[model samples]
Target: MASAKPKFPAIKPGGSLILAWQVKGKHVVVVGGGEVAAGRIVHCLNADAVVTVVCPTSGLNPEVAFRVSEGQVKHTDRNFEQSDLDDADMVLVAIDDPAASTAIWKLCKERRIPANIADVPPECDFYFGSVHRDGPLQIMVSTNGKGPRLAASIRKFIAKQLPSNAGNAINSIGNLRVKLRSIAPDPAESRKRMAWMTKVSDTFSWEEMCKLTDEDMDFLLRYYPENKAPSFSELRIAQGAPDPQGVDPFDGSFGFSVGA
Candidate 1:
C-alpha cells in the first residue's frame, strides 16, 4: 500500500532560527564596484564589518573607489581568485558577470564561507533585506531573496505607519526593561514582569511616557506590587476663561448697556 508522504511544517528561508550567525566585527568581502555592491557594502558597514572590495575598473564608481583609495576599505583591482577568500568571514558577489560570480559562489560553498550572490538565489546563503532605522532600532524586511523590490516597497509602507516618537518610546521601554531585570527575584517572575512592561509600554502615550519622572516610577511600582509599573506623567494645560471682574463683553472696560 502507498503511504502518504510525511507532512512537515515548511520553514521559509528568512524565518528566525534557533541559532543565528553573528557578523559583528567580522571581515566582509565584496566582489563588485557597481551600485548594487555599494548597497551591500553599506549594510556590511552598518553591521560593523571590516569591508573589502575587489574590482578592476576604478571608473565604476568614484565615491566607492575614493573610499577604497583612502584606506577606508581594502581594494584589489582585479578579478577574484581563491586566495581572495582567505581570512574572509563572508563573501558577497555582485559583479556584472554571472559566470564569474557563480565561480566565486561555488568556491565559497566548497570552503564553507557564507556567501550572497546578488540576483542569484541558488548561489547565496543569505540575501540583503530592506531596512529602516529609527535611532538605535533597525527594522528589516526580506522576501528571502525572491523579491527585493517588493520588500523595499513594503518597507516604505511600514515606515509611514511607524510613529514619529517610536525611537524615543523604544528607548524608554529598554530602560524600563533594565530596571525590571535588576529587581525581579526569579527568572519566571522576571519574564512575567517583562510581559506586563511590554503591555504598559504599548498602551501609553509617548509624551506621557517620556515625561515620567522618578516619583512617577515609584508611584507605579508601589501601586502595582505584583507587576512592574509603566511610567506616566501628568498633562496640564491652561483653559481660556475671563477673570472675575465687571467688564463689557465687547469692550475692555465696564460700561452701561446701550438700552439702559
Candidate 2:
C-alpha cells in the first residue's frame, strides 16, 4: 500500500523556546524610526543595551531622537548599511520597505545575530511577549506571532488575577530556607528539616508567619515544644475543617501562605 499522506506539518511554526537575555552592555541595532520602532528602541534601552537607530527619516521617535542628540545613541538617517550590523548583538528592523527589511534580516542571519522584524512573522526570528514585572518576578504571555491582541488580552487577565503580596510571600519563603540551612547544617538533617517545613508550609501561609516578629520567631523555634509540625489530623480539627479522606482537605489550589 502507498504511504498515507502525512496528517500534518512535521513541525509547527508556533512552538517557541522562551528565554531572557542579558542585554546589559550589549550593542542593539534598531533599523526603523516609526512608532513600532520607537517601542522596540525603548525595550532595548530598558534592557541597558547600547542602542543605535538607523532610520533615515523624521519618523524616528522623539524620545530616541532626543537621546541621540544627547549622545546616548548613534543615529544615521540613511539607508540600511552592512556596517550597521557591526558589533550588534541583537537587531530589530522596523522599516516600511519589505525588501530593505528582508535584506537586513538576511544579513543578520548570515552573521548569526538575533533579530526581530516588526509585524512580519515569517521574516522574524522572535516575537515580543506582553510582560508584567514585579521586582524579579515576571509573567510573560505570547501568541507565537499568531495574534498579539489575544496574547495582550490574556496578559491583562493574568495581571488582574496575580496577588499583590506575591513578591513579599516569595521573599519570606526564601528567608525560611536560609534559616533552615543554618539550623540543620548536615545534609540529611537539612532534608529532614525541609520535609517538615514543607509539611508546615502546607498548613500555614507566609502572610501569617511573616506577621510574627523576630522575637516571636525565636520563641516559636526555641521554646515552642520541639519545633514540631502539627499532625494532619490535629490540623484538620484545629482548622474547624472537614474529613480529608487522608489527603489534603482543601479542594482548591493554595499558596505558601495557605490555611492561615
Candidate 3:
C-alpha cells in the first residue's frame, strides 16, 4: 500500500509576504499623510524612489516635503481612484478606511501593480521593514509582518551601537581602496593590502581618529603598516595600576591608617 501523505494548511486568499524590491528610480505611490505614511515615505525616499503622495484631507509634513521635494515626490490632495494607479510602479495604501484600502489592493492586483497595505498585512503584496542607515551602509530588519514593533526596537538598539563616524570610516576605506589598487595591481597583492587595511582599521580607535587631522591620518597610513601598528591594549595596561596580586601588600583591603 502507498503511504498516506500529510496535508498542510493552505495559504489564505490574501497573505503577507516579505520581499525586497529594487525600487531605485521607480515610481512609488503613497496613499496617506499621517505618521505611518510619513515613516513609509521616508523609507521609500531613502531607497531612491520617486514618490507621489495622494491624500484627500492632508499632505506630508512641510519639513519632510521640503527635504525630499526636489521633483522626487509630488503631492495630490484628492481622494484616490483607479486612475491614480496608472503610472505608479509600486503603491502603498495606508489610509484609515479598510474598504478603501481593500479597493486599492484589488485594483493593484488587477492592474499588476505591487502594493503594500500599511496596517493590513493580508491585503499587502509586500511589507516594509525597520531600517538603519550609517552613510553608505544600510541595515533592514523584518519580522515577516508578525511583529513590526519588535523589528523597530531591534533597529534602535543596533543604531545605538553603530559609530557615528562609521560613514566617514567607510568613505576613507573607499579612498584607500583606490590608492591601494593603483599600487597593488595584482589581485593577490590587492587582497593582502585589503586584509592589512582591515587589521589597521580594527586596531585604530575611531574616537582617537576623530581628533586627528588629515595629515595625521596620512602620516599613520604611510608610516605604520599592519605589523607596526601601535598597540592600544598595551597603552591601556600601562595606564592602569599594577594588580594587587603582583604587589606585596599587607592585605587586599585598604583603609586609612592612623599614626597611633
Candidate 4:
C-alpha cells in the first residue's frame, strides 16, 4: 500500500522555531560579568548547566559577584581567552567590547558551537525569549529579536490568565502517569493507558486534578486495566469536597483560549 500523502502545505521560512533545549550537565561559558551576564548565568544555572564566567574583577556586577563569592559559578578573573571555549557546549558574550565579542562569535562559528552575543541578533545562534516558569511548566514568548518588551508583555498576559493551580495539576497528572506505567508495563498497554488518561483529563477540571492524592493514583492503578478508572470528581467527593458547583475555571471560556 502507498504511504499516506502529506496533507499540510510546506512551511514558509520567516519565523524562528522555538525549542526547549536540554542543557543539563552541559558546560556554558559566559564572557562578561555585567548585569546581563548575571541574568544569563542564572538562567543557565536554573537549567542545571555548568557555568563559567570570564571577566576582569572590576567588571563584575553585584549579582554576579555574589554568586562567584559563594562559589556557585567558576570565575576567571581576566578577559576571555580562546581556550575558554575549549570544552564549552555553548557560549554567551555579554561584554561591551565589540571587537572581542565578534572574535569570539567567529571562533564559535569555526567550532560549530551555538553562541549568543548579547544585543547582537545577527551574531547570535539563539535568542532568549521571555519565559514564565511554573514548576515543570514553562511558557516562552519570543519576537525573533525584534521586540523583547512586547514579548515580555505577552508572556505576562499569558501567565495571568492561567489557573493558579496549573502547575500542581500538571505535577499530579505526571505522577499519576508514572503510577499507570508501573501498573501496566506491557507495551501493548500504551493505547489503553492513553485513552484512560485522556478521558480523565477531559473529565476533570484543573482544580480537581490538583487535588489528586496517592490514594487517587492507587485507585487509578487498580482500575486502569479494567477500564474503570474513576473520575477525579468522584475521588474529591469521597474526600469530603462539596459537590462541584459553578463553571470550571479551565473550561476554555475564561478569555484564555485562542479565538475565544
**Top model by TM-score, which number?**
4
lDDT of 2 by residue, 1-260 (tens): 99989888687565798888789999999988777877787777767888888976576677767777887777888877999888999999887888888888899999999999887888778888887766556777988777888998999898788677555555555665666666657886756776766765765665554443343333333211244554434344334456555445343322222223
Model 1 lDDT-worst window of ten: 231-240
Candidate 4 or 1, higher lDDT: 4
Runs of candidate 4 exceeding 4 Å displacement:
1-13, 228-230, 238-260
Number of the candidate with higher TM-score, 1 or 3: 1
Local distance difference test scores for all models? 0.70, 0.70, 0.69, 0.83
Tell me the TM-score of each prediction against the true structure. 0.69, 0.64, 0.61, 0.84
Q: In candidate 1, what are the lDDT values of residues 59-96, reduced to their tens digit? A: 34976777786777788888788899998999998888
Instruction: Indicate the worst ten consecutive residues by lDDT in candidate 3.
Output: 251-260
lDDT of 4 by residue, 77-148 (tens): 999989998999999999999998999999999999999999988999989999988888889898887899
Candidate ordering by TM-score (highest first): 4, 1, 2, 3
Task: Identify the leading candidate in terms of lDDT.
Answer: 4
Better of 2 and 3 by lDDT: 2
- Give residue 200's error in model 1 in angstroms: 3.4
Candidate 1 local Cα displacement, residue 57, angstroms: 5.5
Task: Identify the runs in model 3 with alpha carbons over 4 angstroms from their true place.
Answer: 1-21, 57-72, 180-260
Candidate 2 stretches greater than 4 Å from native: 1-14, 66-77, 171-260
Residue pairs in candidate 4 whose N, alpha carbon or C atoms collide under 3 angstroms: none
- Model 2, CA-based lDDT: 0.70
